[model samples]
Target: MAAKLEGGAYLSSFVDAVLEKLSPILEDDDFVLEENDSALELLGRLERSLYDVGSVLDDAELKQFSDKKVKKWLVDLQDALYKADDLLDELSTKAATATQRDPDQLQHKSLRELYVEACDSLKLLPLGDFPNLKKLMISKCQSMECVVVPQALPSLQYLSISECPSLVSLPALTLTVPQLEELHICDCPEINCFAEEFLPPSLKTLEVTKCQKLASWITSKGLQSEGLTHLWLGPCFDVKSFPREGCLPASLQALKLSNFPNLETLDCKGLHHLTSLKSLAITDCEKLENITEEHLLPSIEHIYIGEDCPLRWKLARRDGRPMV
Candidate 1:
């Protein structure tokens, strides 16, 4: 059909906050500031990009390069721009206003998203529990040690809790608002395990980083299913040994794990029945010495690992023969 112009881009509250945080940073850096003084300018560029992306949303090019990188850059930038609380407050105000003023507005609608430059504590219950919230993100709470997510938010599609030094663990699934589609938990030293109770089946995409004590889900030696699409446990601590039965889920597609200092081996003895695992990644596993791939899944297509890991990775075909 007709290619639309770039005027319809609706910058969400989070995006506005991103632009705000970037405003002074660009200002502080004389060259950057001189080049891009107005956050509106960035907003415009982003809008145009989104408009272009709208036409090709179904294409892999848009999904892989544009959406992934652009969206992820926005998130990572929100995570990195520290010491910009005043800027964040201004944008948060705008977000709050947008929430109250227009319910039918569809320019940019996100469920739960937060931007904290360097906070000691967080009180997000005031943000309220809106069922439409798809993503909840709070970053750079430097002094913040504890967080309690409101249980009323069940339609939560994606939740991101990052860079909180004091966070230990997300209470429990049963106590949570509801299951989500994707979850990104990174850089929290105290938090461990995705959920203290159960793995919500609604979860598909997960990216975890820098959480030291990440071993709480031991409900079964058979933590396998077809629902898991993207799985990541990286930049975490004290992770050693694959699940005793390993993930026997026949629905796994992509997996990434790196910087796990204590990983010793990957013996998916429990996953012998799996026949649908595709991509496998293991990186920076300092202590990983061996990979007993005697009966690994037969559907692996992509494998990623770290150079420091001395394990010899190979697949185990049916009838138990190494395909090295």
Candidate 2:
């Protein structure tokens, strides 16, 4: 845009000048920012450019250029605005005595910035101090072994580890963030346990499918969550029993049970505490021999049974109320 400072150039012509300026900055042999850091470094470079222009340009002209600049406000702008300012200060003092190949002279540099780069073979991961994460999907990471929670994952809310066959364990939970409400640990054949002591109490939903050992989570004493409203426990063929009543503090509104081959019975002896039961569905549980009506949920309003099951439901109501 500097080429049009004479006022003859139309605002439509801004791209040519912007590109002209950007192309050289990219090619500068002294520009030594890593590919990832380039976004920030570029911002730093722009701030530097604006500062350089201030030597000959009036504050009004600089202000005009600044006010008219178009920004996408994506990674690029964040890099320039945030990283650029930090770079300005770092470089000002280090420029004279800086011995390390100044990234300013190179197109790229290596970064040990925030989180370690995902490796091809590493399966288990520890993300204790990860930066600005909103999602961490380790589904395809079949070789993972364990993950450690980061300290300040303020943005993280969604985490999934489906189909990780080799994962054995995850870090003990130290962060009880209510913001992280959705957790998916399905199809992880080897993941036997989670941080029961530190599991998020505010979790409202969990999907633990096909993970046979994950049944331990329901029984683990350390899990004190009371807020779950929806639960999907499917393909957990090894889970022979539901966590006995009173273990789950929340009054589950919707509970779905499916595909537990070894499950003999669903004894909700503790489920009486679940006063808010609204919908209960059971399907594909071939081994379920009985569902005692004595403790049949009082508030339960909806029921959907799965296919391939024959049930001889016994209504033992003393009042002789018509069976639902």
Candidate 3:
């Protein structure tokens, strides 16, 4: 019976699978007969109930570990979902054997964008179904652990995920979504690395904030995309130095580092190859002091140092230096 839905992720996955099964059954107009109207109505009501209950499953999953009541409630919910799934499966089998419709007609081709917010119970996103989707934004999904993009999304351009605390890694974007251009990630602390070795080739802008483990991951990975132009990283309290020699790609045009409280040094060897970089901004780094003269590359036209940094006054009054 539904493989005994165990963890929050598994339960959420099971619920999504049931919902997907119900979609085509409910969508087929021919399936709803005059005699079966009552059954169709019951299925419709069941769909609504599932949606209502699914919203809180993420929070409940977390609480279930500590509270026996939450665990029991989840067990009851899993049982109800299994029964609903069984009923849907029986009807689906009858419909498939009775009539055969063209599979191409069932595809959702025109859907271009999708946004999911605060779906605490959603653990996985079956993005392979939406081939034409261009932009996807997911925010505040506390229980979301993975985003499943099984096939290539040729049309996807921009993806932004924020406040997803449980997210462990992203789908291999460089291989899965080759057309992706912009990626913004914020407040997702658990993510340690990208699923793949490299970022998308089409990516131009990358911004990450308040993600300490991910920040360290990015630094260690060397931020090596050839097309990336603008980069912003901030509020990483553990970082003592940044852009460890050859960490940033030479294609970067503008870079901003902010709110790094423990940052003490800026590696000149790391900035040596950035011939295309024009604007550099460093702010809110209170302990920063060691920025040698060679750290300012010849290609840099504008530099901004916030007052909170100890080197602000030193750089401002330094002769022959362009300061802001």
Tally clashes: model 1: 9
Displacement of residue 104 (Cα, Å) in model 3 is 7.6
Q: List the residue pairs that clash in candidate 3.
A: 58-121
- Report every candidate's CA lDDT: 0.54, 0.55, 0.78
Candidate 3 residue lDDT tens string, 1-324: 223544578778888888898877777776624258888888888888778878998898778768989888888888887677766655543442232333354333555877777666657655645567788898997888988777777888989999999998788898788999989999999988878767887999999998888888777677868889999987777788776777988899999998888989887778877879999999999898887454478788989988888877776676457558
Question: Which 10-residue window of candidate 3 scores lowest in summed lDDT?
Answer: 93-102
Ranking of predictions according to TM-score:
3, 2, 1
Comparing 1 and 2 on lDDT, the stronger one: 2
> Root-mean-square deviation of each candidate, in angstroms?
15.7, 14.5, 9.8
> Largest TM-score belongs to which candidate?
3
The Cα RMSD of model 2 versus the native structure comes to 14.5
Q: In lDDT terms, how accurate is model 2?
A: 0.55
Candidate 3: residue 317 lDDT (0-100): 71
lDDT of 1 at 129: 37
lDDT tens digits by residue: candidate 1, 1-324: 012211123223434555555454434332212334486466456545444544543343234344566545443433433324444554443444233333444222444553444544343313443556656677776655555554456676777777877666575543564567787777877764555434567778767666656533422233433466777766645546764554535566776767767778776763444456677777788687755665456677666556566663322223433222
> What TM-score does each of the candidates earn?
0.56, 0.57, 0.70
